[model samples]
Target: MRPATVFLLSALIIGSLEAKPNIKNFFSKHFFKDVYGTIDANIKVGDAGKPLILTDLIQQDQIDEAQAAAEVKLDAFLGVKSYAGYLTVDEIYDSNLFFWFFPSQSNFEKDPVILWLQGGPGSPSEYGLFNENGPFFIKDNKLVLRNSSWTTSNSVLYIDQPAGTGFSFTNGGYAENQTKVGEDLYKAIYQFFQLFPNLQPNEFFIAGESYAGKYIPAAAYTILKKNPSDEIKINLKGLAIGNGLTDPKYQVMYADYLIQHGFIDPKSRDALKDFEKQVVESMNNEDWDQASNQIDVELNTINGLTGLSSLYNYLENYSDESDDGIGNLLSREDVRRAIHVGNTDYGDSAVYSYLSSDIPKSVAPLVAELLEHYRILIFNGQLDIMVAYPMTVDYLQNLDFVSAEEYKNAERRKWRYGSDVAGYIKSAGNLTEVLVRNAGHMVPADQPEWALDLINKFTKNNL
Candidate 1:
């Protein structure tokens, strides 16, 4: 209930997120969103023609003078401003990133800002926006207000990154590694701040799920490297990764998880043993492509062994594709025009394929270094089979940080939401790992109330 009073990248380019991040993953789809829509139904905000800007609005006379002399008329939203547009990152490549900015519904000046990145390396942030955490959900092709949107108390910027995800586009070569991805993202972020200097003072954080586990660290490391520069100074703070795929090394506990969850017996576990060895051996051999491929193969094998159990959530018989119906919503001509993407195309398989080779490589070193300074929030759904249990715990318990040992031994305190034991959290120094009960890969979608509370508490250091 407490509003954030504080709140990515700066430079030439910005921002997929994926499912499972093992090559398939999502939500934290928002690594992951932007656009103008309704929150409470009484609002007619952020029409492109009268875009609500973040400048000193109280100075109406000044605004009049600016408007009178303005070359380009802009759109405006009510209360806190909301904007959706494209920011060009690469001139030679003609890469432009699309973004949706929804200001804090509670305290625009105080609440922190968040950049949500959904995983899939290719999953549109729109999946997270409309399907999960953003202010509204698209239902029956209508924008329905989501009361628990994180934007209720904090500004959230959702971007379609790396030019090819969502509405982003580029004629240049696709990014093939974390370094290239970081470069484009940093530039786009720089332009974002350049375009909106008023938000420079707010505390900012980067968050995503699934493959964004890799993207988040890449983005953060690039930002931290640029903090001392004068070109752009983002008031960078913390990070959050939901069911991320940071290190593929310790994350080779697939069959163990399946066995513990009762999805497969020891005999079936034995069947996957050879595949597990291949994954580890491939990773050790530095054949990242093969490693990722083996992991995906292992997962498919598991699915075959255990039919009808969703990879996103074991409790559900159907796989959770957060982007279901999302494309339909975005395909509407009015919707495209509303978001300012004029005749542009949506996402495709290219981004996923572009990142496939980069998938199995470990970003654990970057994560460890990041934990030394910024606070890192690691969370997972109890029912998620994608970035399943033990894998997250395996890496968390082994991180080389100031509080690594303390984190190892720290008591998992019971976390409650309205008298219900919602989850268990273990915290020490800059790292905190939470396991949400009855949830899956897309925590925000499965448990919006808990999702909102998490961002509020984590950003405020109240968790």
Candidate 2:
């Protein structure tokens, strides 16, 4: 029998005789399919934490009723599946950790695990699971299979983390800074590996996008420092970051470059240029709100466009007049559909709301948590102006590295994933930076093939 099955059976046999009648009936009726085998039985506990296992003598009818209620609750969510479950960890102030297991195709043994973190200091992993890199995509307004899902090649764990994002939450007192975020993530990683002792330490890689640039690296650094040597380590492979926010200065600098190169309009160029300067001054003076306001202005201007032609036309053609005009590339409907935002929505509020909402918020803390032990990959889409390629490139160019030449050489090499898209690589110690071409801020949405290829190469050390 499988180890999990064996463990479950032992627990059942030990508790069967003492099990209460109500509890026995409950498991027999409600948890048959949900429980894998004889070893897998649900044991409810009283306030004192005593197991209330079900007995063989319980009527099957009562079990059926209980199981039906559970199925209803589980099916209410988008990605509910057979192996779904929850674990409540009270050691960390009564927080609960929810997980979904995407078992490997055939193997029951310990497999490679990819813990996916979403971007946004506030976005939820559900967006990544359903809308972005998960095994499925929304099509015709329905969820459909994605052939290129990363999980087909590895086990993926989508965590709704921290205390306030997704289903993971605390009644009060959540950590917001890098240090605390890293600590919480470390606890989660430790517990996960502990629960699945068979998972090879070396087969794990940390992956996330956008703001994760900051979170992932910091966490990896912390893990490395704590581990020190390879033998005692988690065998972390590397990290993959998509359209991340690594450095404020570089992002601003590149924004200026993109605008000047015709990727954005002259009016955008003028506005952003002023905004950039103001941001630098604000940063220098430690005036974060002032700097943020400048970005908000630029974002509001971009948000005001109403049609697809207006959106893509501006992207394809750069001019001050073009900024105020609409074209044929994308209609207003197209923009609304692509972003999942509504018509008549303007300003950075939409993007900011998404970022600030419960969805992408956990990412910042998780990234801070994972940085110490794994290699880091910061990937970006070239066409995404909000997190522009030039901005990513600029941020990368400024990282303080141990070997300047190796880093410089890596950056100088032209990045090529396919026939037409162009990119470059920057390697500093274990961290690798990859920029995708002809892609937007959402790399997977714009250039999935290239994004997948880049991930494969980076993880395999082929790039």
lDDT by candidate, in order shown: 0.70, 0.48
Superposed Cα deviation of residue 137, candidate 2 (Å): 2.7
* lDDT tens readout by residue for model 1, 1-463: 1111100110000011122234433112211111111111111222223222212231233533332232121221113346677766677877777788887888888789899887777767887888789887777756677899899999998987767877777785567898877877877676666555677888999988877888889999998888788556988789999988888787656778788878777766665664576677778888786666656655555555666346777777653343445655565544555566656666635776787778778888898889887989999988887787568999887877778889888998998999888899999999989999988878888899998898789999888
Off by over 4 Å in 1: 1-81, 319-324
Off by over 4 Å in 2: 1-93, 106-111, 140-142, 228-233, 253-255, 263-271, 302-374, 411-429
lDDT of 2 by residue, 302-330 (tens): 33321112221235432222111111111
Worst 10 residues of 2 by lDDT: 32-41
Candidate 2 yields a Cα-based lDDT of 0.48
Question: Cα-based RMSD of the predictions, in order?
Answer: 10.9, 19.9
Question: TM-score for all predictions?
Answer: 0.83, 0.64
Error of 2 at 457 (Å): 2.0
Maximum-TM-score candidate? 1
